[model samples]
Target: MTLSRRHLIAAAPLLGLTAPAVAQDAPLRFAVGPFQPTAGDTRRAYEPFFVHLAASLGRPYRLTVTADWAGIAVALATEQLDGAWMGPWGLGTR
Candidate 1:
């Protein structure tokens, strides 16, 4: 999703909740659904946020652009992704 610097700053604290357990050398995996019109658009919007986050946290952050919401969910459930940005409704009832 396209996140402004303000949004990222606000989310930093919440995202940090999971950061402690991750090793400093390990890359934090972050996934984003096809929220923007195109993958390139999404990446362009989010790339800077991840870069800033990585710098702020002093750890590398990997951004995975998923084609669909289901892929994001599966990745999270399987622990392939440490975090995700998607619509609340994207998460279906189990």
Candidate 2:
């Protein structure tokens, strides 16, 4: 099975809701897709964003940057990316 399906299946037990349904949880990893990291500057610049998000959500957050378009596609398709910025062709919806 694909990684996406596997992740969903593994998370099935935690998918149930309480009395009132609401998505108040935070994502563990924030994946930035298909972006070129300039001498590790991306990590330094965006690390604070992850830190702030984690602090606000009371959970740990990690920033993940995929190397190139293909990498991003693979990550997206495999569900390794929680949130990403994809270009027009990166989505592979053609």
Candidate 3:
């Protein structure tokens, strides 16, 4: 589920579409699958991009490093996450 910078760039349009519907003051909750060796490493690796995203969108964001696909899936299904950074192949689009 690790994302290259390219993947991040490609997701910008998707974010643009969804970010606006989020409440203006609520922190945007984002999740990531177990992309790195550890959660800390994953968070650190993606922090800069997420920071830039939040700042550029003028919104606060909370990043969560999920332990596995199921963890991220649950977060999204339950609305705990607004978006996620994942490999496109990891989950098929409906």
TM-scores for all candidates?
Answer: 0.69, 0.49, 0.71
lDDT on C-alpha atoms for all candidate structures? 0.67, 0.49, 0.68
Q: Superposing all C-alpha atoms, what RMSD in Å does each candidate have to the true structure?
A: 5.6, 10.9, 5.7
Writing each residue's lDDT as its tens digit, candidate 3 over 1-94 gives: 6665456446655654253544367887777778789999998998787687666556788988888888777777776777777766543111
State the lDDT of candidate 1 residue by residue for 8-82, as single tens digits.
546654654243534457887887778789998999887786687666656777898889988887877777776
Model 2 is weakest, by summed lDDT over 10 consecutive residues, at 15-24
lDDT per residue for candidate 2 within 46-78, as digits (tens), equals: 567557544544555567766666765676567
Candidate 1 TM-score, true structure as reference: 0.69
The list of candidate 3 runs beyond 4 A from truth reads 1-13, 16-23, 88-94
TM-score-based ranking: 3, 1, 2
Cα lDDT of candidate 2 equals 0.49
TM for candidate 3 is 0.71
Clashing pairs in 1: none
